[model samples]
Target: MTLTPTKLSKSEKTRQAILEAAQTLFYEKGYDGASVRQIAEAVPIDPAMIMRYFGSKEGLFSAAALVDLRLPDLGSIPRDLAGKGLVRHFLMLWEGDRSGIGLPILLRSAVSNQNVADKIHEVFEEQVVPAISGLVPEGEEDSCAGLIVSQLFGLALCRYILRLSPVAEMTEQEIVERIGAVIQFHLDAARDTAGSNRP
Candidate 1:
């Protein structure tokens, strides 16, 4: 059977509706708390249809938490300023998101759900690591990536989740200036110690 453009559009719309509904439900109820039936009700579609589209509730949750870091090209950014650039980019993503379905939501869910945590880890390994891999020294990609992820996610948790006074109240420039240096240190540490073995 030939699938016309209109049919394809409709299918895409249906798929998007399912995802949006699932996102909202997952945000409100979390991974374990949000059921397939609840997601189906939110989408106003049949539970079987959601299963058909996403395979299972776990599948739906995975799709719902999918996040694109949209990290800047490290090669394009100057080495001296790469840390500041990355910090600025992530800050912009957090503060400028209008969809309300960014890292914050995923982080919140990840705190309580192992599956969601795994999904967040997957996103970091897939998206964030590749962006910074070339910028780090040859043998330090994994450690550098881990350090970056820890700093970024810690910032998110303190600023957005815990709402720590100092972190939450810090101006974007202050955050960039302070956290940017820490990130830069991680990026540079590998190169600094590339040939030396520490006891």
Candidate 2:
């Protein structure tokens, strides 16, 4: 008996091809610059097939640019270190030249595209907010997470996208310590506020 590998259907393969091509094109050209016909040509498929599969360029981009935050489970982390852990997770993500992660790509387009910006917020609210809900005091979840995300994205833009001085040169651990502290502050401050109110 010989082992056999599972194979994808033609439609599945086509969809994957479109995604790969779209990811590259979007990264290179930005959302407005990359078009349905361009993605279709990269797949070497009929341009109409792109519309057939994804409805429109925006639809294809939405499907292709899906980013999972994959945030660590904060429920199990020590309450005090939750913020550091969250920042560290994002640092690990924004790590490298960021050639492969959908985040840097999304961040790039999000500067100019409302659709992409909305997607980032949607993912963050849906994923990051809930992950830290237990760590913060009640009602502080959204505010804390919002501040953390702003800091994280600002760092990514300067350090990774803009390659700003000093910031780009900092080691990963240095970043972990610095930004991590800010994130931790957001968490601790939230807890502190709630504690203050309790009296």
Candidate 2, residues 1-199, lDDT tens digits: the string is 1122267777777787888888889877888888888888898899998888899888888776777777888888787787678777887776643333678768889889898999888888888889878888778889988888889999998997889989999988898888988998888888898889765
CA lDDT of 16 in candidate 2? 76
What's the TM for model 1? Answer: 0.82
Best by TM-score: 2
Write model 1 residue lDDT over 1-199, tens digit each, in one string: 1235456677788888898888777777677788899888988999999989999887787677768777878898789898898899888877875343646668888888786788787888798878888887677788888998799889988997789999999999999999999999999996777657543
True-vs-predicted CA distance for residue 144, candidate 2, Å: 0.7
List residue ranges in candidate 2 displaced over 4 A.
1-6, 96-100, 197-199
TM-scores, one per candidate: 0.82, 0.86
lDDT score for residue 98 of model 2: 37
Assess candidate 2 and give its lDDT: 0.82
CA lDDT, candidate 1, residue 123: 80
Off by over 4 Å in 1: 1-8, 98-102
The per-prediction CA RMSD against the true structure, in angstroms, equals: 4.2, 3.8
